[model samples]
Target: MGVVINQSIKNTIITYLGFGLGAINTLFLFTRFLSDEYFGLITYILSTANILMPLMAFGVNNTIIKFYSTFRTRQSQNTFLTLILFLPLVIIIPFGTIGYFAFDAISTWIANDNALVKEYVWLIYISAVIFAYFEVFYSWAKVQMQSVFGNFMKEVFHRLATMFLLFLLYLEVITVDELILLIVIMYVIRTCIMMVYAFSVKRPTLKFTKLAKLSDILKYTTLIIVAGSVANIILEIDKFMIGFYNILENVAYYSVAIYIASVVGVPSRAMHQITNPLTAKYLNERDKVSLKELYQKSSLNLFIISGFIYLLIVLNINELYKLIPEQFGSGILVVFLIGLAKLFDNLLGNNNSILFNSDYYRIVLIQGIFLAIISVLLNIYFIPHYGLNGAAYATFISVFLYNIIKVSFVYRKFGILPFSENTLKVSILIFISTMAFYFWDFSFYPIMNIGLKSLIIGLVYGGICYYFNLSEEITKLLNKILKRT
Candidate 1:
């Protein structure tokens, strides 16, 4: 539990730091510097790439994580890891080649009336493969319980690289065509770097042993792909559908809204990086006490922290959107809806980690498939009417219900729920803080003076939480912070 807490802290710091940098890029640079159409194009490419990643990798990343601890010797572990790494190529190489040769035909079919997006469809497809391969390497590191560095590289480095590319495009040092190509190249570079560092951390050998049952591993690997595809569709089908149904500019608006909503889940993503392996380790040891403790505490702590962040975003959303263009400002409701969905996601805490590593993982596939269908149907029904907001609405409803199902499943299987008295207190505190922030006027001063207002609000919020002892875990954390100061 301590190790989980320690790792979660580091992961949270890195995740939020990455998000802070992204907020600047998204709200200021991307929204200000790029047209909404271009912004949508960039987001569409990435969203499309994310959707394709699990298909291309064949889900070996997760299969490796699940089975890594099962290997008895270091040599066997290396051999198993090596197999997972190369096995994807057997499928991806042939598929990628087919894609390359038939790129023009595929691009023509998907190309909408938007001429600019049509011109760049090929680049998006190429970037998708690059992003997929990086996960192949990243998952190898993750199973080793080495996630902070890789998470930093994946979440932070790519954004920083993209920011630099945008600057180059702005300066005319690179043509728009070149900038599109650079996106693919940057992902490829990050993957290469991860591959290099992976060897330094745990040098995997190409040695194959008859002792390692390749057929059994392949069975699990196949399950993971189906599961991964379902999960990806649940998260991303809306974006793809939005692109297909609405104008590229609408996709751009939805992207900004999703970006803002994504911040609510940063803490959850950071925690998942560490928690997955920890859950696996606990499951392997059959340590029910530790598992339940970690599960409950993680739920409470995450809610306390993430709920506060969600409140900040929801309350200050109008002001934050004001930092961008009026077109982006129209995404405020989208942010609120999706933000609430993500907050519901966070409240489940390590429920996902617990379920994913447990025997009932097959249920995840069922639930994911169900949610994916709902997400698609809702988007199709609503997007034509509401445009970008319709997509956001679909995502919010599907994701919120999806999380409830997952939490319920975890409770049914484990006889545990990721909530407690602390959870109730945190919810009340957030409600009060959000109402205060929303009604309190900082309008007397210029918008440039907003930072001071935000700081004051944060201080007051922190003070209330401190005095109330919102969560024992959080109170201890604040004490540690004060001592260090």
Candidate 2:
């Protein structure tokens, strides 16, 4: 738990710093510098690549984490690492070839409604390949319990690079198309740097000698492809579908709202980087007591922290929107809906880690496939009528229902819940705070209003939590911070 908290804090700070850079790009630069169509085109391209990344990687990223702890001996671990490293080539080579032979058909299908997307379809392929290997290497480091630097690479490096690229575009030193291409190059560079770091953490000895449960590893990886795809579709398919059903400009507008809402999820995203490998370690060791404690602590702490973020985003959202262009600001409802969904996601704690790392993943994968189907249907029905707001509706509803199913499954199977007494208390505090401060606003510019409101909310929320000593872990962390100060 100490390691979890320590790394989680570091990872969370790094993730937010990355997101801060991204906010500048999303809220100001992209909205101001790039035409909406191009903005949308970029969003559409990346979303498509995300949805394809799972298929291309063939789940090697997850397989590495799940099986790494099971191999007790050094030789077996080396063989395991070497084996998983090349497994994705099985999927990547074939997928790339298919894309090459059927480029026109593939491009046309992806560019269904937005013709501007056809030219960039190849970029999607390249980006997906980069995205796939990046994960493989990141997970490569995760099994070693060295995630902060990798998390930085994952969350911050690319955004910082993009910010630089966006500025170059603003200065007319580069065209928008060139900016997009440079972004892909940046991904390639990021992945290479991560590869170097991961190798330094635990140098991989190329061992071809395989004398272990290779079949089990292959089976898990095969199934995890669907698992990864389902997760990606639920999160990203909205943007992809919006590209198909609407114009490219709508994608940009929706992207901005999604970016704002995604901030609330920073804690969970950071925590998961560490919790995932830890959960896998516990499950592999059959340490139920430790596992359950991790589940509950992870849930409560994540809820308290992310719930504050949810308040900050939802409460100041109006003022925040005032800073952005009005066209992009239309997704106020989108921000709230998806922002709440993100908070709900945090409430699940390490539920995803438990499910994905456990043997029961097959059942959960089937459930995920079903939920993914529902997400697609919801988007299809809603996007035509509601546009960006409709996409948000689909995301919120799907995520809400999906979290319920996952939480229920974990309880029914493991008989452990992620919630604790503090869970309800945190829920109450968030509700009361929302009610208390939501209608309260400052009469000032957007930046000033946002800052003042955030300060009040943070003080009120943090002060109460610290005074009450809400969770022992959180209180301890606060004490440490105070002493250091």
Give the winner by TM-score: 2
What local lDDT does model 1 show for residue 274?
79
Show where candidate 1 strays beyond 4 Å: 211-213, 444-449
Local accuracy of candidate 1 as per-residue lDDT tens digits, 297-384: 7787778778878877777676666667787767888888888888888898888778766778876877788788888899899899
Which clashing pairs does model 2 show? none
Q: What is the lDDT of residue 53 in candidate 2?
A: 96
Q: Which parts of model 2 have CA positions greater than 4 angstroms off?
A: none
Q: Which ten residues in a row have the lowest lDDT in candidate 2?
A: 110-119
Query: All models: lDDT?
Result: 0.79, 0.92
Candidate 2 residue-wise lDDT at 322: 83
lDDT (Cα) of model 2 = 0.92
